[model samples]
Target: MLSLFLFQISLNRMIKTLSATNYSIEIGPLTESSFQDLLTNKYAHSRKVIMVDENTHDNCLEFLLTAFDDLTDAEVILLPAGEENKVMEVCFQVWNALSDYGIGRNDLVINLGGGVVTDMGGFIAAVFKRGVDFVNIPTSLLGMVDASIGGKTGIDLGAFKNQLGVFKDPVAIFIDPSFLHSLPENEVWNGFAEILKHSLIADSSLWAKIKNYRNIDDLYTADLIEAGISIKLKTLLNDPFEKGERKLLNFGHTIGHAIEGCMLETDSPVSHGHAVAIGLLLESQLSNNRGILSNEEFKEIEETIKALYSPIELDEEQIAIVLELMKNDKKNSEGKIKGILIHSIGHCTFDEVFEEEEIRKIL
Candidate 1:
């Protein structure tokens, strides 16, 4: 009886290993010993390439080099930093660089920066030579919990957000919290918005934990990252293609993305998290106006985000442009704008359409 039971347990473990190949998210420091084995055994024959922005190259590249001795021969491709550079032109440069270097189907691309690097690098690898293997080493807090977990990869189309892209999962994702040490304080705050979004949409317990935190600095830890990542991974497992449950993840992105697009057009641009913080407030107000979210909950959500992020005041003209951009969002259908609104904390409804006039009133 004991032998039979052990056999069943082993069989289940093998089944799980076989089934989990499509997606993975690993959180830990990248040390020389573990990484060397990964390179020697798993990626032995594959050519290696590491993609980074100027910022990451300056701040984070040495850590990777020290971790993997084999990377001495890996080609390094550096793109410009900032959301403004997350465009087709930059992608074109990366693609050209790959072609010039003769990168093949078996070669691996390592995305080693924040959201922009991961998003663009994943998109590049997804299409390069008809999809090559890639891994994400997320350097920013936003990247660690949010961008690196989701298979969504794309470059912005003009002033719009993620207008061109594909769903391509990396073979593995390595999240090293040490990367956050090099980021500025505002960048850390930028990531907290997504964490708050995760909490708002799925975990009320996480929301309670985050709301009490005095500052972004206090929120940086493996447990916090795991909380946000668990929400995202669980959501994606249910709706990998964003056909239903995954849409809930866009809680603040509707207006947030529109605002981001508008800001990208101006000389002064807000970070993705900054724009999302604003979206959280506006959308929460929309939820309140629609009689879904309670008055007290709305106030709490508004004040929490406001305390973390300074207000971004937009003129009427900018509001109009943002509203127009919403029409082009991938979530919309049949000429109606779709939004995800919370009925209460930790619960949300998606595919909720609102009229242009209704949205205008809120702005």
Candidate 2:
């Protein structure tokens, strides 16, 4: 009976491989047996470094250490938690640490935290010794579904988000849903917004399934997570560098990132998902005004987002400041503000230039 049950557990695990231009993303369980296999077969002789944030260091690091006996000698690097610490100074600290420890190009880095840790650690690995191999073990829903798969790695420039970065794919991505068990409710919701964005841009069926869920908890299944990952992987397969369809994935990020940046300056910091939820509503309004998205669809999208997130009251002054930040967005070209606007659910258009006066009116 025990052998049969263990076999059933193995059969139930969902594994998917997404191939990028240069590398692949493997999503599945990170069990002790599986991790031990990875260590013994892949990195038996290579030096290992594991990067974690304060939160993950406290909560999730033990699970990783106990997964494989080979990891006993791996160096541990702890970073300060949160988006505020994702800066060049942190990268400098990481680089300096790698240098002091003599982490060579053949060494491996295992990023074992949320988006902030993965982003910073991946950047450090990409630059140190002219690029070392790294693996991502995402602990947050946001990182697991969005940040971990994409090859884009970077740090913020001042108040700007992801202003400096590179395209460096991880050697492997091990997504163990067990990590999500330790995440706060807000952190879960923070990643759900990206899933929502993926549905809105590509899968009407996913959008329908998501709209019926009364709360965030209902969306935590492995199938739902894989659906979100599939949409992003398909987009990346077509345009890895955001030259066309890939930009569709940025549907709510333009205005959302601006709001997030502004909020970071205030005492009340907003999560990435919260700001994107607001951006979805505002951008949907623009779509409706442009006659691209119907009023009925717009109402449904607005009400659904409003139910999930509270309205953020932004005055004219705040709107003006956000607009200034949007102008600095990397998506812009030839001094024109580019946006991704929806035509309908699961249908979006990217690189749409909007006049300043027109945008101000929508805000």
Candidate 3:
């Protein structure tokens, strides 16, 4: 009986892997009318609630309320905005709000802000009553291209980032570029880091296109957004469970998360995508040093990234501290500091492990 059960579980995983590739990713306008279109889809229930932040509530909720106005009943739960709020405490607040609303497995949760709202909101939905359905209506460029599409949901645990979470995808996602019009310049740059990372991993052509996005408005185009989205979707389809191929997506994330976490300890806080971009540069150099990528390829990546991002000037002490944090990344196994590195501009993955002694030397 045990053998048969294990076999069934293996078969189920295989089926899910296959199905993810077959799934067609949808990208279009996210408006009041889109909600009506979503209502036509098959689901367990129509009762849905949105979890948003202060800025999103002010800029988007009023307009969104009208979108769901015709539904039997829909509500919004607003939280404070910014990365500081992505904690267990905020997760509890959202869970309490959902409980008060009498939300159930049949109901759905909609994440309506940037990475913070989506990450925390998705975590709440994943744990509420064991598990519940949710949707992602990402308002920020970062969320639309990366966070909103991936099912990895979690809240930060103290100095560590995304230390607690589960892989739970939403029922659907709505990507509307119009919402990005109000985004700050830094935030737009933060999102671009992921776009660049996506390009570095699989699509050289996409990388070429991204290099041409000189200004923020360049990212607002549907073609650019769709290209970035397609790169991620294709990767996810190949490695939905993140056991192998999908790990490549973390090209800059390993050190990037650590740097962001370390910086948060001080007065300055680095956005997730920005930190990852830095990670990509440093790690790419490391890859070159290891005889992986050619010098020319490494320089091209560094030059392009530097064009958009000004590197953080860190002292030896700061670099050392951040490298220590990388040891605790959730992706590592048994405390081994495994990370994704590049063989070339368009090829990267998590096949390399950095030694603590060498890491210390680099810092």
Best by lDDT: 1
Instruction: Give the lDDT ranking, best first.
Output: 1, 2, 3
> Which window of ten consecutive residues has the lowest lDDT sum in model 1?
1-10
Per-residue lDDT of model 2, residues 228-347, tens digit only: 877887777657777788888889988899888877877887888888988888888889998999999999898888878877777888889889999998899999989899999999
Per-model TM-score versus the true fold = 0.93, 0.93, 0.89
The runs of at least 3 residues in candidate 1 whose Cα sits more than 4 Å from the true structure, single-residue gaps closed, are: 1-20, 32-34
Clashing pairs in 3: none
Predictions in order: lDDT: 0.84, 0.83, 0.77
TM-score of 1: 0.93
Error of 2 at 349 (Å): 0.7
Q: What total of clashing residue pairs does each candidate reach?
A: 0, 0, 0
- What lDDT tens digits, residue by residue, belong to model 3 across residues 268-333? 888888888888888887888888999988888888888888778777888777877888887789
Deviation of model 3 at 128, angstroms: 0.5
